[model samples]
Target: MPATVFSCRWFALCALLLLGGCQPDQPAPPLDQQLYIWQRQWRPAHEQALSASRADFSTLRVLALQAQPKAGWSRARVDLAQLKADGRPVIAVIRLDGQLPALDLDRARAQISQLLADWRAGGVMPTGVEIDHDSGSARLSGYTDFLIKLRGLLPPSLKLSITALPAWLDSPQLPALLQAVDSSVLQVHAVSNPRLGLFNPGQPRDWAERWGRVSDKAFYLALPAYGIAVLPDDGGAPVVESEVALNRGGERRELLADPQQLATLARQLRAKPPAHLAGLIWFRLPLPGDRRAWSLSTLSAVARGEALASQWQVQLSARDGLYDIRLDNLGNLDRPLPARVELNAEQCDGVDGLSGYTLRQTPKQLIFTRQSSARIAAGGQRALGWARCTRIDQGAWNVYP
Candidate 1:
């Protein structure tokens, strides 16, 4: 070959290599492995749990702690060092107050920039930044403009994403908003009152199909890994509250998706996801001792389409001739266990702990029957009603499914 031809070939090859090097790393091809870390504190237990479940997760979206806006934005506490050491792609999340003044965009931007700078100075580099805002449709234009400006300010190498509302999915500015970010997380779980249900399989499926038809940008469907408590108002209206209140009092119902239900949903989405639907991002990364939320094992089991096992334990106490039996569900999945409880005690007359349940004296035992709409929650317990017995001992009790 001529010297000029050989030189041209070498130059082309060098150019190709340079281009390839300059290209941003294509994100790990949308995996079934992503979780959101909303907790402000990163405990050793959290680290251990993450380490154990590390193989199941490819990305960790950590929330950048922020307090109520007074005059300017203030950084909240975050485990930046731990997050960096986790050895996974991290997405720093800035949860903007939904009620933030629209006029304070510039100030907010400056505060966010400072946060980014601090993250960099601290040696914590995130592959992306996610803006979590619940702005309404009317605020779409402002939100979109803010995102545009944010994109301009963000480093070109880093991607930008947002947690999108289902309401905004139908807005005309949605496409423009999506265009401003490299990817978005469409949360399809909390469409209705969580009190009604944590998630309805059909709602997410329908929304995913609809969203898939609309935009072609990369996205993930945020699913619930947590449970919520729904208390009835004086007027019988369902009011959703945090799980903490469930222990306080009142007739509140705890809502959570069954593991089987979640597994089925996962299978459905995996089999037929939207063109842009990347994968599922669980609402939370479960830590050890997080009773209100599904554990890492449960999440893994659901992802693998496996059934969750139920463990039940009963504790008996006696006071004032009344035997109190507490039935606790020590399982991961919220499921109905055998409500018919049989006690090996004679002359057991009346019972009082659970409402809508009846105790009948059989020839050999006392059988407690559960009424309709009665179910046990995982890691939760219900009183089996006090039984009027002559003596309370470690009597053999059997719970029938």
Candidate 2:
């Protein structure tokens, strides 16, 4: 070959190598979908949700399914066969109580070993094990020690993961602790203050950015799919209630979230994810009849980047001298439907079946509005109230936004 031609080829090769070396390595594709089953009892709704078209979860993180600390060792009850039949990889989660930090290392190791043995015996071996602990910053050292010991006990084939708190990232020991595990799940949701709202809009972005800069370990972000009630305390300050309270004949109040917020968060994460971020893990898998949670269709739509729209319908019916006003939500998103139905007082004498709703008498129309939380689920309907009419005129009834 000519000297000039040979020299040019060599230069081109070197340029290619330098460019490849300078370019950042692409991160591995994240887990497309994941969910945590915190409830012990497996309701039919759970099965239905799992089978639903929208629930295309690739992994199921089952909590407290097989193991719990008892006596000196751990007690386990895992149904490996059933889990295997679920047609997805299972990540068995073992919840540690406050007693974890106080337990003897040797005893803790033995209990964990026993738990694994129980799982193996039941043929329900997990693809990975996740330690769910909300260890405080002060307990970082202890938590790190526990993880290191746990890693030593875990089989080389099984991945060891943990549910990490944002607070842990602030600790200097975080990087070292992360090194001890194969992967970690950063719970970006539930960090919101009840006094503020069920969720903080900026939390996901803030945590992801912080985690990207500090940690080099692979991790997933856990987001919320459920609602929380913010009740007023004795001092009138807002406090988070344990759960949404409901009764057959009692007042009810709730603070429900719009799932679109989660979609917005997902978009932000996808647009700017941390270098080590793996994917998202929903705080829970919502099931049918879970009025307080997003429906499967809504979640799927959000995941697909589809906009959620509202659809409402109202109907009036009468039998004898009594009349009924019903409101329905036909949209994919759950919304607070119109709680008040207006009717001409000349046609309707009085209203009933609205125990928790208040009635207002205007000059021409009667307005019945809900006094508490009155949200309707997608495709769900509820009676606004019934009216006693001097003459039932269904055409005169109307619903307000």
Candidate 3:
């Protein structure tokens, strides 16, 4: 395999890491475990916690099954039971299809019943179910009916979740489907057509705009675990690989996300997070010996939620009648010192515009040189921030002090 050259900004690397990586045999955490470390670089923390709590190490889920089920219902049953005993949450992803599977309803029910029994007996029920289906105009009545039936059959204690495509933004069936499942995870990675590179990634932004309109309680933000290599003329399946970056010396290397990007994601979740945004989950695991692989170290740091709070604390003191964005420690906030602050009046205070002023520590705020007109008016301030945010969405600016 040829080494990948690092091209985009740090954020782009993080996004790609979530999209295209493919790996096998990474351990799965048990369902009973409190933390589900998706990225492998985080193993140390898991080990640390295991030692401290004396908690039994559990199973970690693997996306082994294709979108379609090839084996018989009995085979699936056996797999489900084994995964249950292993203690990891079993996420059986079924791609969307208008036609039912080869198994009859009776067989499906029997297998499901057995799986549930085994899970309960082993004290390892799934955290929830995950369904990855594309959105289309063909009226998903048949699929919806199946889901409704599945919900009725499952133990009420368990949750039913589905992965949604960007097209859900326009489809009429979404409302009904959202009503059917316990939670819906929007695949924010490839919301647009992969062939033309027509991705606007407006899906997350659209969610933010309508957060107030929707009432779906828990939603997951499903980013890509690997990057798609688009071909000219005709669209083809994207080649999935582990994370890799090339240094100035031109050597292929694994690129791990800096603490800044991780913390930014956490803040996004905290601000306009998906309603009931439980936690972030990195897509598919990395391959063994892949240089750019995301490791357990990154996962552990993110899970602890210290990736952000530990760095860049602000102590507000009025300086020259303007709020100065100070730093307790110069972590990622590197530019210069004693930076002046100012906001762009024209673009400030809106969802779409890159609102608010950012200051560089090079002894001055370079971006806005003139004046600071950014003000919080009482009446308009109610909806200005994420006071009404109830869904996952794009952020207008980085929440930095």
The best candidate by lDDT is 1
Off by over 4 Å in 1: 1-30, 67-76, 232-239, 243-250, 307-397
Q: What would the TM-scores of all predictions be?
A: 0.71, 0.77, 0.47
What TM-score, to 2 decimals, does candidate 3 have?
0.47
Instruction: State the weakest 10-residue window (summed lDDT) of model 1.
Output: 65-74
lDDT, candidate 2, equals 0.70
Best by TM-score: 2
| Distance from true location, Cα of 363 in model 1, Å | 9.5
The lDDT of model 3 is 0.42
Alpha carbon lDDT at 20, candidate 1: 95
Error of 1 at 86 (Å): 1.8
Residue-level lDDT tens digits of model 1 in 133-168: 888888999889888987887789989999988888
Total backbone collisions, model 1: 5
Candidate 2 weakest lDDT stretch, 10 residues: 243-252
**Cα-based lDDT for every prediction:** 0.74, 0.70, 0.42
Clashes of each: 5, 1, 34
